[model samples]
Target: MGKILITPRGYAKYGDEAGKRLEELGYELNVNRSGLPLSREQFVESAKEATGIIVGVDECDEALLKQCKDLKAIVKFGVGVDNIDLDAAKALDISVGRCVGTNSNAVAEYTIGLMFAASRHIVAAGCDVRSGGWKKPTGVELYGKTVGIIGFGNIGKHVARIANGIGMKVLVYDVFDIKQEDLDTYNAKSTNVEDIIVNSDFITLHVPLNDETKNMISTKEFRQMKKSACVINAARGGVVDEKALYEALKNGDIFASASDVFTSEPPERTDWVNELIAMDNFILTPHIGSRSEESEINTVNKATDIMIELLENHD
Candidate 1:
């Protein structure tokens, strides 16, 4: 009944429409003064007075939740809730929400686009044309290539379908097996992670960020990949060790990489990471996996609409 706290810099993009509706419910909005992710103490102090919060990648651990006594709900800006401590929120009687399957297709499309962009060095070609150079960049072909899709959920499955349509053979590596129906429909093959990594011409990740996955693709895994294989990560950061990835790229162990997320949200241009960028082998995007205008509006609408339903109908 008091107010809602919005964190980081993207409220208007994701929540402004829903905010208009919430205004009719008499909610004031407070934004984090910090321009980036909030530390636990900082998040708690700023959000303690609010009944609800719209968050983006800020730390919402048990300590922060404990301080926010009046908190009623949390609306994560995107699909991944790795930043929020759900157990504590539940114990504290706060309802937690996220936009699931909202941007799967958009992200899947971006993944394939990145693969093409990397194999063809599209970014470098644009720069070459801009610089008045006529040198045609040699780019690899995706057709007939074996694409290893790690974590075949909605996004990964969609990626496989598109890749198959483009004449690429899809090999999926999921903890769970790919269903026979799905494998047949998309003409994808299910295999173990080791085989997929060793065999894939291009590898893209689609999974959550958590214990079993943090630094999941590191030095050992890099060693398993073909020297000519490339990597794509539009999923959460830290899945591939950026440092190791840089080393691999620098040493020509892997052919190229395209990453949409980073270990750091506003990921800095570290010297090693920049080295990869300087070479044509690496492509970096600022976590805009779900930034489609339609996706943004739908994410906000879905989150706020659910809260509105819960708030107005206690019966």
Candidate 2:
């Protein structure tokens, strides 16, 4: 029987049935007990004897992959695999799988929520009411606004759908070309990133974190946006430079901004992050883009299936 290590904090709770299935298939399940993402040392220690792993955000670099000689398969519970070292995994002959599209709807909905929260000052307004203040801040409407969607992948497509339903014009910027029929379906137009950055009323990022995409939106991009525009990043962190974002927000280069992911998880209370958090127009969420109950179940099942197949079929 092969041993499978599961390192995602939510897997044990949301993946109990999947765990049972793996056990029934004769695999020993070693789940992470930390209730948080495993550090590099913890991950290496936990994964040493396992033939497979269901990972989340934990760094699986070349050094760690080489150390875990028994590790044959890695199943990513979420879409982004930036934390996993793919080149190293391939070199080490370990199979890597990701549960793509499993959390699309969940993340897409959250992106819309962030947009509304920023545009309407929803968080600030709620705080005011709770604090015995009665200030009704003027806010912008989504209807008829131009929404720029960066990277029209699974999550981006769903975001476009919701934006269209809200009567917003959607401009899509992606590296790959989207079909005209598909664009027409959502009443969207294929445009360059520059156009989206300059012309959008609300800009939402959905790109992955990679060398090309890292710091994709910095001071220059922020400068291009209209002063009334609001930016939403429910995608990966590091895509937008936090320091540049701080400067932009502080100077009112853009009206407001919201981010669900950051360059670092449980971001340190650095001066830049603290300053950004202190701004009323800046909204931050602790990377809950795929935290919905439904999304969790779907991702867990998908990840489990992939792990089982890879391990069972390994020669």
TM-score of each: 0.89, 0.97
User: What do the candidate models score in CA lDDT, each in turn?
Assistant: 0.84, 0.91
Q: Which stretches of candidate 2 lie over 4 Å from their true place?
A: none
Query: Which regions of candidate 1 deviate over 4 angstroms?
Result: 8-11, 14-17, 30-45, 309-315
Tens digit of per-residue lDDT, candidate 1, span 125-243: 88888989877879889999999999998889899989988999999988886789999988998898888889999999998999999888988888889988999999999999989
Worst 10-residue stretch by lDDT in candidate 1? 306-315
Pairs of colliding residues, candidate 2: none
Error of 1 at 145 (Å): 1.3
Error of 2 at 101 (Å): 0.4
Candidate 2: residue 6 lDDT (0-100): 93
Task: Candidate 1: give its CA RMSD in angstroms.
Answer: 2.8
Number of the top-ranking candidate, with TM-score as the measure: 2
| Structure candidate 1, residue pairs in collision | none
